[model samples]
Target: MSANADRDDRDLEADPASSTSGPVGVPVDAVCVGCGRTRVTRTSLEAMEIDPRVDLSDLDAADCTSFKHVCRSCWAITWRNPIAILTGLLESERGE
Candidate 1:
């Protein structure tokens, strides 16, 4: 089932990132760092290649994090375009 992104991670009773549902149903701990929304769903590393906006080619396979979360707003507005989100991530990474 599609998760409700509006829910707070702190209140979740299960580990949403886990493949199997936890004690309190899938625990929702993933909140979008971009929008502070809980709408981000974890995507496998293999799935990243399918997304045109994401570029993992430069990074080593072992160094790359297995999970990627693109929030609704980012996916729709910034991430869908690639360059926009890349700039955003770069700026954020630079502590700007």
Candidate 2:
């Protein structure tokens, strides 16, 4: 197996959160760090690539850790034209 794959396997084995049952001892209402979306359980947030090491015990509904939550339309637009979005943001910033 490739190095990265091997490493991932090791990490999976070592991390309790990566287990099939999901993160043990973690809160159920943790917010996703990527999309700022609240996941009622670790399994729900697992789909967002959240690091298992991040603390979720004191997570609040209003906290946005990483601006991770984007509506489907916004995600689609971003995937379709990242450059266009950046250009628009730059233009707006420059008042042009």
Candidate 3:
């Protein structure tokens, strides 16, 4: 292929409509209450848009200092052993 042909094939401007490719300016924090672990990541705006159907009562936390984020790994572990996770949480709270 000629140089001109290659230049023509290349894109001059990025598609702003593309949500997948761009600077990850949006921040997302996921916290696991049981182990007290936090996972912070930057993603696209579209990825974090709130869904009306989802009840975000936690968003209105009175103190505004609460643990509502949970990493995917922790969620998976909870699904596999919910009783163990819940028990551990309770034990930690009781200092037992």
Candidate 4:
């Protein structure tokens, strides 16, 4: 089953990303850094290949960090309150 992107990661009892599979289910394309789910937009993945965030480039081994991308759900949240998202990222880097 596809994940409910609206759900908070903290509240998830089980990894929704793993819900699908084991016989018959949609294949997981890629995981989301923001939501930890396999739900993602083709456009966003394409965008990542085309132009990633400049600020995220210096992040150690960006391929592992994936700080440049967010899920469609988190993208919506980011657009609504980018300050919050940026602040959270900064705080995490600060070990806060």
User: Between 3 and 4, whose TM-score is larger?
Assistant: 3
Model 1: runs farther than 4 Å from truth?
1-28, 44-66, 76-96
Off by over 4 Å in 2: 1-42, 63-96
Query: What are the RMSD figures for all models against the true structure?
Result: 14.5, 17.3, 13.6, 15.7
Question: What alpha-carbon RMSD in Å does predicted model 1 have with respect to the real structure?
Answer: 14.5
What candidate 3 gets wrong by more than 4 Å, as runs, is 1-10, 15-21, 32-36, 50-96
lDDT of 1 by residue, 1-96 (tens): 235553554446445545332221211234444665544243333433433234433433333332344566666432211121123333454483
- Cα lDDT of all candidates, in order? 0.37, 0.37, 0.37, 0.34
- The local lDDT score (0 to 100) that residue 85 gets in candidate 4 is 17
All candidates in order of TM-score, best leading: 3, 1, 4, 2
TM-score of candidate 3 against the unseen true structure: 0.31
Model 4 C-alpha lDDT per residue in residues 1-96, reported as the tens digit of each score: 235554655457455544421112111234555566554222221223323333433422223223243457676332111111122334465583
**Judged by lDDT against the true structure, how good is candidate 4?**
0.34
How high a TM-score does candidate 1 get?
0.23
Candidate 1, residue 11: CA error in Å? 44
User: What's the distance in Å from true for residue 64, model 4?
Assistant: 12
**Candidate 3, overall lDDT?**
0.37
What's the number of clashes in each of the models?
A: 3, 4, 1, 0
Candidate 1 weakest ten by summed lDDT: 77-86
Tell me the TM-score of each prediction against the true structure: 0.23, 0.21, 0.31, 0.22
Choose 2 or 4, whichever is better by lDDT.
Answer: 2
